[model samples]
Target: MAASNVAAPLSSQRPLAIEARGLVKDFDGTRAVDGVDISVPEGAIYGILGPNGAGKTTTLRMLLGIIDPDAGVRRVFGHDRPHEIGRLIGYLPEERGLYPAMKSVEAIAFMGALRGLPLAEGRKRGLELLERHDLGYAAERQIRQLSKGMAQTVQLLGTLVHRPRLVVLDEPFSGLDAINQGKLEGLIRTLADDGVTVIFSTHVIHHAERLCEGVAIIAGGKVPYAGSVEAARDRIPAQVRLETRMREGAWTHALPEDARREGDFFYFSLPETGVEPLLKTLIEGEAGILSLSIERAGLHDAFVAIAGEAAARQLEADQAGGGA
Candidate 1:
């Protein structure tokens, strides 16, 4: 079993909105999840990331109490069963559907009603949300009449109508275009800014990288890593990118032994001796430095390093297959 860092050092001080331990799930005779564990801090944007069929959705279902785990335990806002606090939690599942016959605002209201908001209040808030989101014109339109992106936005507004404290979104960016994806990302940030805890699952590393403070990397029904995004990224060394007009000089000797060259650019891990000596060498050796930057490894690079290239490849394949 792989070790799990269920919480980051900083998040450990905050109250947790969700926690799971030794979560196990089986489908027929196949073990789909094996001893998965995760911790989500209150009012944080967390991500559960994995390629398709890696048990991302299954783990989320278990957390939301949509399905019972075969073994282990989970708690949402201190409730063993999430449904007991359903109104305080909002979920937008991977399989999205709204009534094609119902008007957009009515649909949002109806969804709010399911979460315990009164119909009249839901309808009032539904319209307000639509207008606030620039979807006021679509309020009276039937769901089937709206574009896919518009309909998805309507569903999302419904998810927020009851002002849930914690929101779980499964593959929320799967079908969105670049523009709508940006919009969703902004909305997620807004929610977190308002002290709402947002947890989303995605195979797209960029989305998780940009939006999540913490993440759990699930693979083959197990968690390989679960902690701050920064921690995951730190597992790989910071990369130093150096571009110089002079291809070769005495300054080349100052580069890390493992440094690789492509044209006039050199890429390598930041040297243990640090960059000051390197800059001095380059300047004195007259190595015509055009650009120099040292950057932490991005989440994509970290994902490939931690989850392996096969999982990374599958993630790319899944995104390509989804056409988003």
Candidate 2:
């Protein structure tokens, strides 16, 4: 699909938790982010998706005030200066770290402290959170003593310790096993259920597709599409899949011009005239319609269509390089 076709700005009635316009950033002499515009609705699970080296991190950093944009304007929770509202936001950068010697509960408390939560309250909340999430056993263990997934979970718990209104996680699913990934997904849902605006960056489309209501598709530092997932998928029509008893018949004429057969099944885009007329034509033409199914295109298909084959290949190559 052409970029223009999917470029319609997403409109939401909810107040925006984060908004940026024409965000441009440069590092040294290289342009890392160019003309990125993002709008995240309050309490929505939004996603920033791009392949590695596509400036996802740079864009996120600029929004969080860790780095300044060379050209752009951004407002976080209505504040012109994002850092001024640091206590109201929780961020987990791609580069993960902790004081390895600190116990899990203490580490969570320390992170909370950095965000202005008192030590005693942070520790109390940290223990309660750990116990609530079935991590009480690891609460007293030092970070170095836990498994990688356990440590990552600890860090994530720390991100939530202060109970910020917005949470930003960069490549959070990285280095997690399937079980832990499922747990993280549940945690994200729970956060959103509690009305937290959760925005996460990931190259993995499945993660975003399953959890995000809105998404920004960034490639080579440019946002080609940013809108509701439904709008993105609707760029292409729903697909029709059919199986007939016979491969050749008059019914074939009713099939779309682009329809193709693979063994016994034929597939094509759903006809604009509607399936009822097509079915009538097929039945009258003696087409043995064994079964039929029509389904909306998934986010994976939509991503390929919107971002183009080259961008899809870039994502595949990056995932392969990184062991995803």
TM-scores for all candidates?
A: 0.92, 0.95
Q: On residues 1-324, what C-alpha lDDT tens digit does candidate 1 reach at each position?
A: 233434444345779899999999999999999998888889899999888999998999999999999999999988999988999998998888999999999999999999999999999999999999999999999999999999999999999999999999988897899999999999999999999999999988889999999998877787878889999888878889999989988888988888999777899998777889999999999999999989999988877777778888888898779832
* Residue 1 accuracy (lDDT) in model 1: 26
How much does candidate 1 score in TM-score?
Answer: 0.92
CA lDDT, every prediction? 0.89, 0.90
Question: What RMSD, rounded to one decimal, does every model reach?
Answer: 2.5, 1.8
Residue 257 in model 2: lDDT: 90
Clashing pairs in model 2? Answer: none
Off by over 4 Å in 1: 1-12, 243-252, 281-290
> Model 2, 149-261: lDDT tens per residue?
99998999899899999999999999998999999999999999999999999998889999999999988888889889889888889999999877888778878998999
